[model samples]
Target chain A: EPEVTQTPSHQVTQMGQEVILRCVPISNHLYFYWYRQILGQKVEFLVSFYNNEISEKSEIFDDQFSVERPDGSNFTLKIRSTKLEDSAMYFCASSELLAGSGELFFGEGSRLTVL
Target chain B: GQQVMQIPQYQHVQEGEDFTTYCNSSTTLSNIQWYKQRPGGHPVFLIQLVKSGEVKKQKRLTFQFGEAKKNSSLHITATQTTDVGTYFCAGRVSSSNTGKLIFGQGTTLQVKP
Candidate 1:
């Protein structure tokens, strides 16, 4: 089965530095999403991207966060400035269809560590 | 705001025992989806419930959506060692089609042999 794939399985960055987490969603999928899970915390939605624009975002996805589909296959989440609290496992997910009820396939996740 | 809460943060049962996890949302959901993530792995899609009072089964696993579309349940019958994982229930709001899901805290199941 085709699955979402994320790059840099683990990332470590300095506190004020920028980090970009990359993901290649299923080739045919149209919608993409980014979610984060703090250690031992529930996974939290960050943003959703479709048609090359952000569909929705949560408070956690503030000024520092931005998502881009720079190419046909790559979906990336960029954080302008990392903080200690920004450390977590970031997951990229995609669905075969665009509906809210469609099944989402998630990547193994990129563990971001900020120090 | 969408809030999904799953009961029994942790469950430990002997092999062959039945295990169930409940998910409740503060608002009506357009759909409810279940996912399983083994320790050290990512969440994997299991099944989705779209209609109110809908029920679907996959082998030993069964899922049900509440009559009001605000709650759901996943039951695993005759659990085994392979059933050990964290089960998460995610909800999509009725009017949102952005594919953004609000996930519950999750229920971790430990099946002892």
Candidate 2:
């Protein structure tokens, strides 16, 4: 089955450094999203992207966080300055534009670690 | 934004016993999705329930959506050791079509052989 792929299975960065996580969604999917799961916590929605623009975002997705679909296949999330609380498993997901079916296909996830 | 709540934060059962997890949404939902995450693994889609009072069954698992579309349940029959994992119920609001999933805290199941 075709699946979403992400780079850097794990990353370690300093508290004030910039970090970018990359993802390549399923070729035919038009809606993309970014979610995070803190250790032993619930999965939280960060942002959703469609038509090259963000459709919705949560409070956690503040000015320091940004997402881009620089190309047809690549979707990236960048954090200007990483905070200790920002360390979590960041997941990239995509869904076909089918109505009434809100199934999400998620990637393996990128574990971000800030020190 | 709608929130989903799952009951029994954790469950422990024998291999031959049955297991069930309940999910309740604060508001009406357009659809409810179920995902399973193994230890140290990412979430994998199990099924999605749309429409009021819908019931769907897999080989040994059954899912139900409440009549009000605000609650759902997942039941496993004769659970096996392989059924050990965390199950999450995610809901999508009726007003949104952007495919954003609001996930619940999840129910972790432990099966003893």
Candidate 3:
């Protein structure tokens, strides 16, 4: 089956550095999302994208964070200035239908470590 | 703001034992979805419960949604070592179609052979 794929399974960067996490959501899926999970913490929503624009975002998705679908297949999340608290496993997900339909498929995740 | 909490942060059981995890949401949910993450792996979709008092089973695993749509549970009967993973219950409000998920803290299960 097709699945979401993320690049750079592990990323290490110094504080204040810019970092871009890339993902390729499953083809044919219209809805894409980003979620983060701190070590031993709940998964937190970051942002949701549809129709080439952000549909919703969480408070955690602040000015420093941005997402874009550069093309038909690649979805990217960029942090302008990374903070230590930004270290976590970032997951990319996609759903064939609506979010409430509940069949979101998640990527393996990119482990970001900001020092 | 909405929050989803799960009970028993960790569970260790012998192979063939039964296991269960409970999830509660601070607010009403239009639907609830379950995911399982194996050691050092990503979360994989398991099932979704949409109706109040809904119950669905997949072999040894059973899932139920609360009558008030504020709680959910995952029960695994005769669990094997492969069942050792973290289970998360994610809640979603139908009012929002952005596909964002409010996930529970998750219950990590360890099954010993």
Candidate 4:
């Protein structure tokens, strides 16, 4: 089956440094999303992107976070300055239809470690 | 903000025993989805429930949505050792147009052989 693919299976960055996580969603999917999970915690929604722009974002998605669809296939999330609390597993997901209408396919996730 | 809560943070049972996980939402949901994640793995979609009082079954697993659309459950019969994983319930609020899902803390199941 076609699946979402992410780069940098694991990234270790220092505090106050910029970090970028990249994802290539399924070929035909329209909606894309970014979610994060702290160790042993529930999955938390960060932002949703459609039509090359962010459709909705949660409070956790603050000024330091930004998402971009640089090309037809690449979706990227950038953090301006990483903090210790930003350490978590970030997952990239995509769906063929609207959020409530179809199931999401998630990538294996990129583990970010900030020190 | 929407919240999804799951009960019995952890469950341990014998291979032949049954297992069930319950999920409750703070707000009525337009739809609810279940996902399973093995240790150190990403969340994989299992099933989705849309209508109130809806029931769906897959082989040894049964899923139900409450009549009020605020609660749901997953039941597995004669669980096997392969059933060990964390099950999560995610809900989309009826009032929101975005596809943001509020996920529960999840129920971690450990089946002993």
Q: RMSDs, each prediction?
A: 0.9, 1.2, 0.9, 0.6
Check candidate 4 and list the clashing pairs: none
> Which runs of model 4 end up more than 4 angstroms from their true locations?
none
Error of 2 at B110 (Å): 1.1
Question: Which regions of candidate 3 fall more than 4 Å away from where they truly are?
Answer: none
Which candidate leads in TM-score? 4
Highest lDDT scorer: 4
Docking class of 2: medium
Candidate 3 lDDT over residue span B14-95, tens digit each: 9999999999988889999999999889999999999999999999999999999999999999989989889999999756
- Model 2 misplaced regions, further than 4 Å: A98-100
Give the worst 10-residue stretch by lDDT in candidate 4 chain B: B95-104
Runs off by more than 4 Å, candidate 1: none
Model no. 2, DockQ:
0.64
Please, what are the lDDT tens digits per residue for candidate 4 over residues A9-77?
A: 999999999999999999999999999999888999999999989999999999999999987999999
- Sorted into a CAPRI-style docking class, model 4 comes out as high
| C-alpha lDDT of residue B49 in model 3 | 94
